[model samples]
Every structure is written in structure tokens, then in C-alpha cells.
Target: MVDRKLFAGHAVRRMRRRAGLTQAAMAEALGVSASYLNLIERNQRPLTAGLMLRLAEVYDFDARTLSAGEPGGGADAIRRRLADPIFADLEIDRAELEEWLSGAPGGAEAFARAYDRGGAGTAASDAPDPGTVVRREIERWRNHFADLDTAAEGLADELRQQAGDLFGAMAERLRVKHQLSIRILPLEVLPDVRVRLDLHARQLQLSETLDPPSRVFALARQLALLEARGEIDALVRGGAFTDRAAERLYRRHLTGYYAAAVMMPYARFLRACEATGYDLELIRRRFGASAEQVAHRLTTLSRVGARGLPFLMLRTDRAGQVSKRFAGASGSPLVEGPGLCPLLDTFAVFQRPDERIVQLVELEDGSRWFTSSRCVGPAGGWSGAVRARFAVTLGLAAEAAGVLAAARGLDLTGGATPIGAGCRACTRADCPQRSAPPAGRTLLLNDRETGVSPFGFAGD
Candidate 1:
């Protein structure tokens, strides 16, 4: 049937297939019977407005494609379908529908899917924050990297002598076996450039857009992908990819870990970090990485036998916007999920440049962990746009405190602040910024007993 209404149905079918969901499952999510939802997909029924909003709310689907004419390449059939009873009295324009479809996939798909599923009168929900999405993506990669470490550890002896220069060795292997040329160019001339792997001439061109340190880093990344294909495959095969988009994200993430491993050379970096007592600045200078980069690399030292303490690394701007986070050995369960401890004065360190070190204790699930935080400035010209208060933090469990190199001087056990995940999830009843009560706590607002803390939760 040349039903214009079926256009959105087709999109839903495509997305559902990509998401690996069966029709009955999608129907349940839409609050409709499987047969009814199937009819809408088959263009037997017009999708109402309510159903559109529900789709957006549930699957995080784009809503723009709902009102667009018949889905797919059959434009003429869609136009005929649009002219049916559904649009006979309505003043809908096909051109407008096409324009909306071409631009807003997220909004459209949400609307059509929602309407087809019998959405209530509720309004569509807000799109999720991109920062949150990116953070979650990073956490997934961190786990994937851990797997790579395990595999590499098993292959250590076979690759021992070649470990330090594995990238170089891999590149040479590729060149000798595949007849490829590797060249590095300067950063100023090729800013934002990266390695280009050419299959035609079998050449891998490294971007000159980086310094000598970075040139070698990029080469190593290329070599990792080429030489360690089996390792990479093992890491990726465990993931359930719904679409080409997610697969592409996995590949890009893999390339990044490879690049980091190339520059840091896991074994060498770990030894240096141990010898130097984990000095952030010293490591940054030696590895030609930014302060944030250094902290990130430090957390990844858990490759094979040289596992670092499960340290949680976070970098935030003066405004408390977290730029990056890495979960080391501590495996702080909070790494992948939402909610941050607002009282964890990591952000304040940026306010005072000379005051390099500050410590606080956070209580998660009744267990206390000591966290050390500091702000570091960016290298290069002072006039650069980099913020002054870029804070980085390292935390160690109270019980496992002595193992850390830095925690050696501090008291093994001490009194500390009882912090919670962000203000909403925090049980601290005295916090002024507590907009919403915590998940399972009663806020007692006694004028005489109210403390200075923003939210004051009675101590258990």
C-alpha cells in the first residue's frame, strides 16, 4: 500500500531492527497490542500525536520523522497516502514534512513511534545531556581497555623484547609485509591532522600536525590496529552493536586506547610512575601529555600484572563541569552512572593556584574513601583559553589506603566528610542546594537543629 503514513512505520521498523527489538517488545513499550502496532507499521492506521511523544520518552528516539511523508524512497506513493482521509480535511504540506524528515531524525522518529504506540497526553521528554552520554561512552571504553590488558598480559613473553617499541615493530612489519610508507609531518602545517591509512598505495601517512612526541604516538596507534587485530577483535566481539553508528564508535575508541598505549608504553610508564611517586607534572613533561592526559594515563596502568589501585580520576573546570573521568583499580561503582558528590571540594582547588593539595573523605554505601584533589594550569602561553582551575583527583579506599605511594604520609584512618552523590541523590539533608530529597531519606527541617550543610540527613 502506497500509504504516506507508512513512512514513519518503515523508519520504526528499520530502527527496531537496528536495535534488535521484536515487534511485540516494541508494542509493550508503546503500551499497545502487538497487532495494533503492526497495523500502524503496515500503514493501516494513522499514528496519533500522543503516540509520537511516548516514543521520544522511552527509546531516546528522534521525533522529527513522524509527520514526514511516506517513509523511504517512495515519495510518490507517500504523496498519495498523505492525500487520504487523514489529510483530506487537514492542511498538511508534503514539502514541510519532507524538510522536517531530512533534518530532525531524533525528534521525528520519537513522535511517530510515540503516536503509533498510543501515547498519553503527556509532553515529550527532554533530550538527554550530551555530556552524560559522552561520559558513559568513555566508561565503556575503559572496560574494553581492561580486556585488552588481560589479553596483552597473556601474550607478554611472546612480545616482551618488542613491548617498548611494539608500535615501531608493527609499523616495520606492515611496511615489509604490505609495502607501506610511514611519514610524520609537523603540527603547524597540518593542524588537526591524524594518520591516514591508504589501501591503494598501501601507505599509512602520519599527521605532521603533531609534535615529534605525538608523531610517534600516532604511528604507534596505526601499528596497534594493524598488528593486534586479534586482540582488538576479542575486545569488540563481546559488545552487542545495534547499529553502524555504535560499531563506528567502538572502532574510534579502540584507536584511541591504542594511541594512548603507544605514547605511554604501559610497562615503561608504570615503572616511571612508580619511581617518580606519581608526580602529575613530572609524568606530563616526560610523556609530552597534558595534565589531564597524564591523570588519564595513570588510571590505565592496570594492564596485566602491573595493576594500579582502582583509582578514580576526575578533571573538572572551575565551574565543576567534569571534563574527564577514569576508573582505576578502585572500581568505584559510581564511575559509569550519574550523580557526583558536590561537596567534594575538587572544584575549589582551582580558585587558589598555589594551594596545590587538599583532601576530603566521601562515604559511599557506608564506606569512606580518602580523596586528594588539586588544580593544574595548562602549558604554553598564559593568554591561551585554557581555564586556570582544572582540577584532578585521586581516591583510595580507607581500608586500602596504605598501598598508594602518595597516601604513605597520611594517617591510615581518619575522620572525614560524609558525602553523597550529587545534591539530588545526596542524603545530606543540610545541603542548601538539595533541590530534591535523596532516593530514600526523610529531610528533617528543624530550625534549631538545621546545620550549615546544604542538605542535612541524620547520620546513621
Candidate 2:
């Protein structure tokens, strides 16, 4: 018999938590009741191989993680070991007993508890890569600025008036410093003339197909990196680093941040933003920037002492893939790392081209943010393809005041919904897509009926 007693419950619990499924949610997906799932999770029920396999399939966990025992201790040992933890009142002694319990639920829970408190910070170098850490750092800054947009507005106004030609001068340097070149061909030439980089020569060449306005932006992004490499490095130097791959990822991430900052140049952009009453379109026109570029730059207002209204900015295609995300005030709430917000109805907007303003949704642990979204694309001239297929939104807490409420326009606080990535850190009970219950909640069922959401918000 395989000793599958080592922390089977612990492993299951962890996987369930990470998957963001509540016991009821998991039970619904697994075709079982919440109580049965709770039994398996609490080490009260010995997990059968068939049931174990089912869990692995349903939750996307590796089979090895599901059957937790000492190295090579088969499934039975995993079960027995986990069951041993609840047998504290029982008394038995054997050489194998110690080995069996060593890898059991009690031990696994201890390790997890330690790790949660930051005691176990190291992971082996060969661990599978989680690609979003560096990306999340960028999102965090975007959120910071979004939260402070009002304050940053005052600063942006001052900088815009004062820093006339600084960006132009930087563009001039790109022409002189590296013999950089720009061209403007028809849109048909996009396939070949888009942009190319010659890393060895330290030169960036852009397609002649882009209009003069966009061409300037391409040039500016490249030049911005070259000019601000030092500042970029200084910012990412102290991050939680694991390997060279992470460092390089972070460096490229910083390049985009610097590029956006240079274009707006902080103080000037904030001043213009405020004077224009946070008019995103006006800023784009004045700066000759694309809507996406303008929104991105707007989110970077967190730098220096100035801040913006602190909004979350996301650009997604009709398909749910997120092309860009900027966090201006709060850090990204995603614990598993940043990706598309499932609730953001970007595709629907593409269907209704005339709806310039619509509400975007996000639900997490019961807190909902009602956001306004609009589409953007190249404006006028060079007709052939409709280049505008992007949406932009200004999100604020449904209950917030001033610009926040102004963006929503009507009072939407009545049923302020809950939306978020998941329960990894979510506190909402009314989320329909909730896959897991709140962290630390006991798996046992309570009498209260869960509302419409898959995971009912856990009562305080």
C-alpha cells in the first residue's frame, strides 16, 4: 500500500486556495457537495486515487502535488500521513510511523504556514517561471498615479507650460546621436516598415508607413530609453530578483515607464491635465499622442511628488488578451500576477461602435469598481483600414467624490458590485466566478444560502 498520508489535505487546501475556488465552487465543479469537499480538504476523508485524479483534472494541479507523501511514498501513505495529524488523541509507536507522519498533513501545514509568514523565501533556481512579477511592478505604478490623478494634475499643468521643446530637443538628439532615421510611407507599407532595432549599432529605425504624429512617438520611445537608462536601472535595482532573465525583464519594463514619463515630463503633464479638467482627448491632441499612449503616460503620474486621480488603465483587444495595463494608485490586486481582468467587457464595445462611454466592471471579494470605457484609433487621413479599435476608461470607486463621481456621472453606489481577479486576496462574497473561498475560512458548510455569486462573500 502506498503511504499517501503526507500533507494530502494541506496540498489540496493550498491548491484550492490558489485556484480561487470556494468549497462550494469546487464541489459544484467536481459534482460533489461542499461538505464532501471539506472532508477531503480537512484530512477527515481519505482521498481515493480516482477522486485525487478528478481533483487534479478539475483544478489543474499536478498529480504529484495532490498525493503528498515522503519521496516515493505512494498514495496510501499520503492518506495515512494526513489522517495521522487528526489522531493526536491516539497513541501508537513504530519506526515507519515516524516516517509516515513526517510527510503528513501536520508537517505540510507547518511548512505552508511558515512560508506565508515569509520564513521560507527561497525557491530552487529551476522552478517554473512565473512571468508576471516584473509586469505587476509596472501595473503598481500605473495604479499609484491613477489614485493621485487630481494631485498630479496640478503638477502636470506646471510642467506642460514650462517644459516646452524639451521632448523636441530629445528627439533632435536621437537624430544626431545615433544617426536615427524616420520615414512616412502609406499604411500599406506597415508590413515591412513598422519598426526594427539594431541593438549592436544602438539605432532604432521606424517604418515610413506611420503618420508624422505616430512616427514621432516611435522615435520618442526609443530615444527615451536611451536617455533614461540610468534612471531606469536605479528604479529596478532593489526588486526581489531571482535570475538574469528577471533582471532583463524588469529593465525593459522600466524602459516603457521612462518613455511615458519623458513624453509628459511629469510636472508639465500634470499641469496640462489639471488645466484641461482631466480631459484625456485634449491631452492626446495637445501632445500628439495616441489614446493608448496618452493613457499610459497619464498613469505614470505617480513619480516625483505629484500624483493623479489614481486610476487603473487597461487596453485589451476584442479577444480578452490585455495588451497593456497601467496602475496609477493601488498595486495590482492579482496575487498570481497580472493578466486580463475577466469582467472588463471590451469585446461588447467593439460590437457597438457608437457607444463611446460604457461601464466596465471588476469584482473581487465584494468590492466593485464601476469604470467608464471608450474606443480610440488613428484619426483622419490615410484612409484604408479603420485603425481605431481600442477602448479607454476612467475607473473610480462607485462611492468616491469629485472627479471620481463625475466620471460615473450618475449615482451608481446603490449596488456597488464586487469584482476582482480572485480570492487569492479578494474579500467579496458575491462574485459569480469565484473558484475558492476566502483564505483561512474553514471548509465546513454554513446554513446561509450563498447569493448569486459562485463564492458567497464570507461573513466577517
Against the hidden reference, what TM-scores do the models get?
A: 0.55, 0.55
lDDT of 1 by residue, 81-188 (tens): 333223433445656655554445445545543332224453335322333333333443333265454344333334345645544654665677657877664545
On lDDT, the leading prediction is 1
User: Candidate 2, residues 279-341: lDDT per residue as tens digits?
Assistant: 777887777666667766655554423455555566766665565555444332321323334
- lDDT at residue 277 of model 2 (Cα atoms): 59
Evaluate model 1: give its TM-score.
0.55
Q: What lDDT score belongs to each candidate, Candidate 1 first?
A: 0.56, 0.52
- Candidate 2 to truth, TM: 0.55
How well does candidate 1 score on lDDT at residue 230? 79
Q: What is the lDDT for 279 in model 1?
A: 63
Candidate 1 lDDT score relative to the true structure: 0.56
Least well predicted 10-residue stretch by lDDT in candidate 2: 68-77
